[model samples]
Target: MKKLINDPKNVVNEAVAGFEVAHADIVRVSHDPVFIVRADAPLHGKVGIVSGGGSGHEPMHGGFVGFGMLDAAVPGPVFTSPTPDPILAATQAVDGGAGVLHIVKNYTGDVLNFETAADLAAADGIQVRTVIINDDVAVKDSLYTAGRRGVAGTILVEKIAGAAAERGDDLDAVTAVAEKVNSHVRTMGVALTPCVVPHAGEPSFTLADDEIEIGIGIHGEPGRERIKLEPADAIVDRLLGPILEDLPFASGDEVLLLVNGMGGTPQIELYIVFRRAAEVLQECGITVTRSLVGNYTTSLEMAGASISVLKLDDELTALWDAPVQTAALRWGR
Candidate 1:
């Protein structure tokens, strides 16, 4: 309930306004039907990439709008999917004649809305493709999704796919690269505390002081189980076990390991988790070639973290190393 805002109903609008002003150099915002696009959009001949979901996960679809990432991002209300109108607007705004790709997380509302927008864009003569990200190894189905709920691994899809598009890959090629990333990546999260939506004025879920939820979804959905608080290494093992087993990532496999904060977890704690995760991977003979540890995708101000492992090949490794300039993630630029 304690948040800095003028009104609960206006949280998204106001936040979007602030974000526009703060990151103006890299992005431009459209108000009528809210959407964020790279400052220099419609990169003719390069495939346009767009992804979106609820607004709470900052620096996600929106912060990722820039060169070598997303061309456009449509954000809905907190933990809510955006309507078709804004999605279509974003699609049109980024279409540069080559095509547009929709990188949607596997949420029911997001999937349907993006599908509708894609059909509408197609009718307008814009070639459109869609890739559903289902990288969560936590659950096969959640209240918000029919299949495995997409989690932190979504950023991997957007980044890798955007790199392919930036390199002038065609629509099909970009979509293929996106699908490949989704398939190779696996993620699992643990929540120590729940987040409160601005409008709701109450935490989405409850957790005892010494309790934790393992395999949690980004939107505060029920996870695999709730258990007493354990050491950071033990929790990391629980999460990474399912991920490594699900992908069957074996010895000699190279990976890009991401230790992502849910929202409120500190950077120091994240590195603590990463240390143990790295040690475990080394023990298994898996090579941690690339690593990312931070709050890239979040759920408002929840105190938690998720671990993502992306099995990498030579092509994926190169694409991941490509230059990217975005509000949240900027390197090799």
Candidate 2:
């Protein structure tokens, strides 16, 4: 119930307005049915990348719309999947004679809506393709998803694939890179507190002072289980153990590590978890060539953290290092 806003229903509108103004040099916001497109959209001959989901996970589909990242992002209500209209608008806005790629999460509503958008765009003579992200190693089924839910690993996929598109890779090439990241990455999260959707005016879930939800999804989906709170090192181990085991990462394997805060977790604590994650990977002889530590994705004001590990190869690493200028991520520019 405690949040800064004039009206609960207007959170997404207000937030996007502020965001557009703040990052206007890099992005442009279109209203009357909302969508975000890069400041220099419709880059002739470049394949466009579009992605979206519920609104609370900030700096995600929207913040990533510039430079070597997404060209457009459609946002829905808080924790609600967007309908197809804005998505189709985004598709049309970014199409520049080349194709468009839709980077979608595995949530049911999101999957359906994006699929509809792709179909609508195709009917309008625009080539459209999609790559779904289902990297959460937490649960096979959850509240909003049929299979595993997409989580922090999505940022890695967007970065790598967006770079491919920016490098003039065809739609097939861009989609292949995205799928590659999704297949090689694994993520798990633990939540200390659930977030409140502005309209609902209540926490999405509940937990006691000494309890934590392990392997949680970004939208407060049920995780593997809940347990008594543990120390930072223990939590990090629990998050990374399954990831390393699920992927056939042997010694000397190079990987990219993302220690992401789920909105309310502090930077110091995330770094503490990252420190433990780095040590564990070192023990396993996995070399972390790149690491990002911060709130790249978040659940409203939830207090939690997630870990994403991507087994990398030469191509992915190089693309990841490409110049990317955006609201949240910028490097080598």
Candidate 3:
């Protein structure tokens, strides 16, 4: 595996340090390890927003930390959950007088850890609310399992709900918007190649030259199925079919589409995916209201892409269009 880093053990802290130097105006490191809070944090009675997951999905929970997104992000080990201590610290650091909202993905460890942190914060008299994002349509939701893992769609929830909080919406209103976003979004992903975790020092899973795994999770969990490699259009059909059939987004439904790249995919390939995704949406009579493409979230050196669709209403569209300045995404001049 080829990567530019000194040691696997220090990867998270080293990356966070570099991130702080690169985005000094927007983020600051906590006294605790692997936790990054907004430089302008402690929004002083504004509902604090905290989200995190394993490392390697850069520009996610961390890159979203800024003026109108997440207020703090707790980092886990590569593709692992942040333990209870850092998560609790993140909750405490961002909690203004209003409350703190934890945006947790639906992974088992992540869900359990964030849930524990929320409980601990409540014990400290900090109002803590959480919106668990399980937007991945790939996983079968059942009584036994943890449901679908939260994927790229969580970014949309964070953006829209953080906008609500930035406008001085109450904690309940912020949490409500987050829940609303969670309801509107669904995602499915596919992988062309496996990614090598730094510590693992090898690919998490293997894919042959002419094979692709459909319905992949970001962390290299087993996908729904593996199929022979096909052209971009055919690949998109496979990706979008379940999303459309299950969600049944009908004609004239306006939507937001995010074509996200796993770390190793190129922009050219992403655009190829986007081109077909747009065509498929148009053919289905769905209106593509807004679109974002590129590596908003990534697994470490993984060659894959996930398509996330959020059916949008006026409120969601307005919140999505609001100004956002962060290291990974910036808009609204």
Candidate 4:
């Protein structure tokens, strides 16, 4: 209930306005329908990469707009999918001669809305491709999605696919890379405390002080189970077990292990989770070649974290190592 804001309904618009000012050098915002585009867009002959969903997941779709990543991002309201008009606008704005790819999460509203936008863009002679991220090993269905909910693994998809596009890969190649990342990645989250929505002015869900919810969604959706709080290592085991089994990531496989915070967890705690995850992977004989630990994707001030593992091949490794300069992720540049 305690949020720093003028009005709940205007939170998205206002927050976006602040973001535009803060990162103006790298991005530009369009207000008519509200989408964020890289300041230098329409790179000729390069495939345009765009991904978006509800707001509140900071440094996600919008924060990722920049060189070697998303050329454009369309953000909806807090935990709500954007309509088609802005998505189409973003697509058109970023399209070069190559084509545009929409990286949608596996949420029903996001899928349907992006589909409508793709159709509209195709009508205007813009080739459009879509990839749906469904890497959550937590659940098969949730309130927001029909299948596994796309969780933190989305960052891996966008980064790898965007690198492919930045290297002048064709539309089909970029789409394939995106799908490959989605297939290789698996994620699961746990929540220690619930977050309050601005409009609702109350917690979306409840957790006792001594309890935790495993396999939580980014939007505070119901997770796999609630149990009395356990040590961080035990929690990491609970999450990593499902993720590893779902992908069956084999021994000798190289991976990019990501320990992501759910907005509120501190870096100290995140590293604890990562430490245990790395230990488990090492025991399994899975090599952790690349590693990322931080708040990449998040719920609105929710106290939790998610661990993602992307089984990496040489090609995927190179793509991840490529230069990237975005608001949230910047490296190799």
Candidate 5:
């Protein structure tokens, strides 16, 4: 791979170091173990919010460390779950006697690791609650496997839950808000090209120059199907159709739309997707009260995009508009 780094194994550590130096005013790096938190965290007695996943999705778990967002973010290797030690440490650091809430994405490793951490924290009398985000509508539900994988909708969950915590809501209230938001959210993604993990040093999967993968998961997993590349409008139509049909939004329903690029896709292309998505929603008689389009969550240099629709009530809408100052997202300043 043509990546600038010291070593593949040390990439996560070095990246954490560089991030701390770059944004020291807003974030603080943990010693030895890899955990990030707001520079001024642990607001006495406020519920701590912790979320994390694999390392390739930068500015995600880490970039979201700051006021009105996550209190601590743990990092794992590329597309791997962080171990229980760092997560437990983060839970301890942010637990201000109120409790700690973990916003974990629905992945096998992530679920296992966070479960272990919760068990560890329970031993120390630190109250811990978890809300797994499974908003991707692409995966089929089965009794044997997880229903759906979490995707970009996680960002919305973190923001809304953090806002609730900042408002002095107890652990139960914060978790309730989190669960509510999780239920209201749905996401779907498509990929034009595959990404190469640094350790693997090769493309995770193969795609022709003109082919695309629909319903792609973030970690280079095979999508539901592969098809020829189409125009931006058609692309948006294909991406949005499944999500809309699955939920079947009603008239006068207010929704928050997120059009996220998968690393390599350009903002201009993302905007095109957003425009088409808005048109499709309006035609369906759904009202999009708020829209955000960009590379919020990303695969490692993959050329693709995902769309997430969050059906919002007044409470969720107010929380969505609340102030946030994370490195990856900033609004209502």
Candidate 6:
């Protein structure tokens, strides 16, 4: 309930305004539909990449709108899907005559809304393709999705897909690369605390000081099970075990690792978890070629972390190394 905001209803809009002010050089914000597009959008002849979801996960769909990444990012209210209107506007705003690709998580609302928007845009002469991210190995079916939920692995999809689009790949090509990433990626998370949505005025879920929820969802949804807290090494093992087994990575496999903090976990703890992750992968003969450790995707103020592993091939490796410049991720300018 103790949120730094003038009004709960205005949180998303005000946050978008703040983002525009803080990163005006890189992005431009629009209203009515409420989307943010790359400052130099409609890149002629290049496929436009667009993604959006609930608003609480900052530096996600929006923070990622920029050069070498997304051209447009639409945001909804906290834990809510953006309506079709904004998504359509976003598609139109960034359509440079080539086409547009929608990267959607496997949430029910997200799928429905994005699909409707895509259908609408296609009718309006904008060629649109979609690649859904369902990399969360945490669940096969949940309250929100029929299959696995899309988690931190989404960041990987965005990065690799964005690179493909930035390199002027056609819509089909970009979508293929994105689909490849989604298929090869897997993620799992644990939570020590929960988040309070501005409207709810209370923590969505709660945990004891000595307990933790494994396979925690980004929106504070319950995980698979709860257990007493363990050491970082054991926690990392439990998380990585399922991911590695699910992909069934082979010896000498190269992979990209992401150790993401859920908003409240500090850098020190994230690095601690990363250390164990790296060690565990090494023991399994997996090479951590590219590793990103930070709060790239997050719950509002939850204290926990998620581990994402992407089994990489030559094509994915090259795309992963490709240049990217965004608010949360930047390299090779």
Candidates in order: C-alpha RMSD to true structure: 0.7, 0.7, 1.6, 0.7, 1.6, 0.8
- List candidate 1 stretches off by more than 4 Å: none
> Against the correct fold, how does model 3 do in TM-score?
0.97
lDDT tens digits by residue: candidate 3, 231-312 = 9889889889888877778999999999999988999999999999999999999999899999988988889999999999
Backbone N/Cα/C clashes per model = 0, 0, 0, 0, 0, 0
Residue pairs whose backbone atoms clash in candidate 4: none
C-alpha lDDT (0 to 100) for residue 68 of candidate 2: 99
Please list the residue runs of candidate 4 whose C-alpha ends up more than 4 Å from where it truly belongs after superposition. none
Count of clashes in candidate 5: 0
How displaced is residue 261 in candidate 1, in Å?
0.2
Q: Could you give candidate 4's per-residue lDDT for residues 286-310 as a string of tens digits?
A: 9999999999999989999999999
lDDT of 6 by residue, 1-333 (tens): 677898999999999999999999899999787999999998999999999999998889899999988999999999999999999999999999999999999999999999999999999999999999999898788878888999899989999999999988999999999999999999999999889999989898789899999999999877788999999999999999999999888779999999999999999999999999999999999999999999988998899999999999999989889998888888998
For residue 55, model 2's alpha carbon misses the true position, in angstroms, by: 0.5
Q: Per-residue alpha-carbon lDDT of model 2 for 264-284, expressed as tens digits?
A: 999999999999999999999
Q: Encode model 1's per-residue lDDT on 16-62: one tens digit a residue.
A: 99999999999999998999999999888889999999999987879
Q: How well does candidate 5 match the true structure, expressed as C-alpha RMSD?
A: 1.6
Report every candidate's CA lDDT.
0.95, 0.93, 0.89, 0.94, 0.89, 0.93
Error of 2 at 251 (Å): 1.2
What candidate 2 gets wrong by more than 4 Å, as runs, is none
In model 3, pairs of residues that clash are: none
Question: Candidate 2, overall lDDT?
Answer: 0.93
Q: Which stretches of candidate 5 lie over 4 Å from their true place?
A: 141-145
